[model samples]
Target: MAVAPPTTSQNPLQLELQALKAQHPQYHVVIWATYGGSASLLPGARWIRRDTLSISTNRRNSWNFTYGTHLYDYYVIIEGKFEYHNKRMKAADYSSFVASTAGFDFGTKQSVMRPKPEFRADSWMKHLSDDLLRHGPLVLDKQLDDVLDDVKDFLEDNDREVVMVMLSFSSASAVYEAGKPWSEGYRIKYDEVPDHFNREFKKDMKKDKDLYTGKKWPRLGEVRGKVVICRGWDVDAEQDQWGLHCRLPKWEAAHGFTSNIKPSALAAHRWNELVGDFGKQDAPKSIVLAACLHHDPADEESWIPPLQTAPILQRKAEEHIRKSTKKTKHLWIYGDEMKKKTNMAIAKLNFLGSDDVDFTRPPPMTVKSAPVLLVATH
Candidate 1:
């Protein structure tokens, strides 16, 4: 079990923005990914959940962000979960195909000799590429479509210009790159990227014939009101390539923290350790951090206290920049505590709106005080 200490700090959101304004003094766009707590706290940014803008709020939305196209036109895609078959085929069929090609499936089902009319085995790359395309971005295309559409809707709603010109990287991008292909028995794709499959997918999508001719998939600069999807690896050949940032979180992953430590205390400590990495030349101009203040009440493993998340993330961000001797400027965004509280309260009320509702009182909610620091860093 982990414990956390307290720290006093002013409003993290305000402090972060003031620092950005003072440091950049020019237009900047941030592409970030974090949990809801941090998303809601972005100062001038708008918080649009993946569903609120793309589909019905009833569906789970993964991506959330504030529109900053006025400053930057690029879409720095970040961030996860659950599982579905990418081949969209039944297990038996995939097993049969694999057995016919690999001599056995899971080393159990042997490939029997075919009947009189036999055939040559398909190229190994053929089978491999098929599986990769099906399991990779192809399966994710629809969900990503929803995200892109939501961004389009925001642009339309606000009448902002759309363009994706550049790509940048942070340590988070490295985490994503670290995701190797999911292969079980032979360990075929461990820590390896199937470049051939990715290139082939891109080539097929770019074609002007058949199913590719008319699709919602945003092609590079092909349509109006659509933004290009840029990968961090594509930004610069030498430095911006995919890899982990120097600062690794003490926790398992940055997605959610579940220890008994108070949210603020945990965030402050993590920031203290990670702030130095902000000075890296390839550090993101804008960071999308999972708001520490917003924890899933339903997530029993997560031990976040009310309001501590936002302040903790904010404090850590400020400290990251101030302590760094490198002359660099950036902004960090996380969730808003008050907004989360309002939303959480409303959700509770909605749960009881039904006549069949047996529950009366809402779930437990609590708040704790954290030490604040009044000194300014210039």
Candidate 2:
């Protein structure tokens, strides 16, 4: 008696097994196992008992076995006692065991699959850092906007009655290169300075279209009136020479330091001028200075301390308004200390308030001890 060949009308399991084999021609045998055990059968059997079995025929197809408990009981024999005894072995382990018993070889041991690129934390960090480095200016501008927003929130939190907003730069020539004067005497006149600054500011703003369009100034609720001043002065006397006549004299006098002054003194002078511009009626209770100071790369001996400048400037501002009835409740300095390079060195100060100083006494003056020249010895 001869047996008939398997046809489409065969049992569903056999047909499915045949299709699986046909789908993965590389896989010689696909061992499908089902655990036939109950939770009540053993004390800790549930811990090892998996709801479904995991099997990968190839890289593309992963098979999950979820047939009824008795489907392969006769052949596989993984019933109550058998399942409890072999609970430690997983579905893949069982497949390997059966394959080894029948003298078949699967590949090396399986490894835990890695997460997708988007799901990885380090990938997100790398992407953000790369984007920031690529678009440095735009990212810095957005950060400035965020800083301004925080300043606005801070002012609101304090419930300041009168607010003053001032933006001052130590060296305007550093930022607006085209606006710098040709020579010392031929410097751009004070009258032409505003036009030059406006032109340069507009040009720079136009360069990046995605810059923050919102109001850079903070808006206070209770204040009847506010003073907002944005001014930039040239500090590089050797390069532009305009700063010598334009604002350097005033800066030197107000700075109270020697002619050869540090960037911190220049910054302090600028802050004093910003605060002194307003009269008694509009004197501010809270002051905000967004100061931009230039760091000379040639002078390696001197380092720009972005942290200390705010307090020094605040002291100068307090002294300037000492006689007035209005006292400074808050003074925030958001400083950007930039060096002469392709990329700017940004230093940010967030919500730094002023320190109380005894202004009735005279301001401390630094006495620069002159070098004593010894006469030619006898």
Candidate 3:
């Protein structure tokens, strides 16, 4: 299921790498690239050996990159369905990193209340420091800012503005933000994130919603001079802190999308209108995005193209294209799910898989996308 990395570099694998090189002529130059996800079909999809593609969460291999080290000019930390392997290192080096495992008995001692409990009224959410909890978009402000600082030191690029694109905004696991962008991981987390917080987030949905709203990207070609911070979901689908580069398609709460507004879906629906009215419309200066993946719904509360979600995705894409201006705005999506989704929303998803890709490991094999964001215990 790991695609075997191609022992001898076969036909498709070679071709794929070559094509990526053509599109992204800057390979070794990519200083901070966090790898993960299945975007083999995307036209411009290219990944730098960008920091070891930290697979410790996917497996138990030795540490790959340096702790507290800065090698590139940019630092992009991806937080998704991954758990880093840092137990062996001194706390100082890996002190702020994270690695998480999914599916549990709830009553277990160690994990029973490790994170979710700390955030839920029935158990957690009260004691944990919002400094690192990532329960919503605002919660990420600090942590994201810190990471940005690190990137700044590395690239000699100091830009304050932060941009984020969530795939599972309204997703429950997405409560960490608000499931704005849809993902494939939250579907399996049917119960991890709490449901109560969702209502609270929905109140702010009319603003800049998360992954679950079923909207697309907003129009941002207007600002031709601002320094932008692009944010998208981690595509690895691994549960870790540095995995924030791409969006994962999973279910909710702390472990998935952290928002309540799925604005991406809306963008997807209005794609046509947006493109047509581009120069005539008033949009944001820049935009960051999280193009995550989610479950293939089969029932009501989540079924048939997952209702409004599809429309949102389309709109977001248009918004992304609109914001490509070189000024304060740029476009970034964590996972390449769109490359595949662009062709077919449904395809051979769960054929050959592993905990490397499937963190929750459900029956159908695919992870859930985004769910309504709810408080862990509220």
Candidate 4:
């Protein structure tokens, strides 16, 4: 008889769930169904018991249980094979039920689901190692290549010329270096052309040869498109490793622009300048593609409000392209802090269509009269 592969009694996922519950006693941990092997391993976990309870009843009872008390601040939903009316309940249904019971408005709370680990710990670690290796510069290069390929296809399909502009901070030196090898692409210095409209400088740029290939830079009128990379001005690459230390005053001064001039205006001005330099009468319908980082400062000392430049640039580009054959698109990659800052900045703009879309506003505060610990098990 063939022997089956040996299996361990301990499940990695169960251990994670147990640790999560232990670390956060304030959260209400709910397992949707009782069928999963790991569900019973979680201590102090609540069972939905969908076989015996309806979602509406659960909602009503949960509210009644905590109506006059403060039971849990948040709900952490765990997945299991749940069924209702002989139909399998989806993970989304569990999330929706929890959201409704917790009185969480749509999009207020993000789901906290962990990725399923491999059966063996070693296998899981190897998978994680591979994932880490695939990220960073390699992944960024692939992403840029994909975007450029798509843009090229679009240009061919539409018979249009485009100018792809990439804006990054001095901190993203790796990304800047990775993009340096693209054909007809060049990095622009902060003070190279103080006056972009200067005829002499424009003429000089047309005659400039690539230091590597000895090929003259493509004039906007001669080619389908060109890539221009712009780095944050006056930011020390050595000091600001992540481009988080950029000061607004220094940035404005570097560009010789007045204080408080929006970064979006500067970006638009650059785009127009590029268009004017390369634009031909026959190719009036030009496309602009911008990619930039959205940085949110970690402290007051390092705060850079101009990091919220992406959305304003988008709005300005949209307005400029309206009723014209020109097209514009932008991509902003941000982290958790960046997301919060950008949302707050956008909220302050007050240009959003609906009051319901307030991102910076917090939910109404309530008083906690009593504490409740309601833990159910299979």
lDDT of each: 0.29, 0.26, 0.25, 0.27
Candidate 4, residue 342: the lDDT equals 38
TM-score of 1: 0.33
Per-prediction CA RMSD (Å): 20.0, 34.3, 19.8, 24.4
Candidate 4 structure lDDT: 0.27
User: What would the TM-score be for candidate 4 when compared with the true structure?
Assistant: 0.21
Tens digits of per-residue lDDT for model 3 on 203-248?
4433422112322332222111121222233223233222123232
Best by lDDT: 1
lDDT of 4 by residue, 1-378 (tens): 000111235555446445544554333333222213221221113311122211223334432332211222222333232122212334543322221122111111211111122222232223221211111111121244343344344444433222222222222111112343321221222323233433442254345331111122223334333322222233343422221121221121121333354556555654554333122332112222222221211112211222344455434433443433532212111111123333333222222211133334333232232222111100
TM-score of every prediction relative to native: 0.33, 0.25, 0.25, 0.21
Give per-residue CA lDDT, model 1, range 1-378, as digits (tens). Answer: 000111124544335434533443222312122111121221023221122212223345522223321112111111111112334334443332322222211111111222111222233223232211121111211244343344444445443333231122111111122243211111112133344744554464345121112212232224334343334333333432332111212222223433355765665655655555455454433332323321232232443432445444544454444455554422222222223333222222222211122535333211111111110011
Give the Cα error of residue 5 in candidate 1, in Å: 42
Which model is ahead, 3 or 4, in terms of lDDT?
4
lDDT of 2: 0.26
Spell out the clash pairs found in candidate 4: none
Q: Who is ahead in lDDT, 1 or 4?
A: 1
Which scores higher on TM-score, 3 or 4?
3
lDDT of 4 at 79: 27
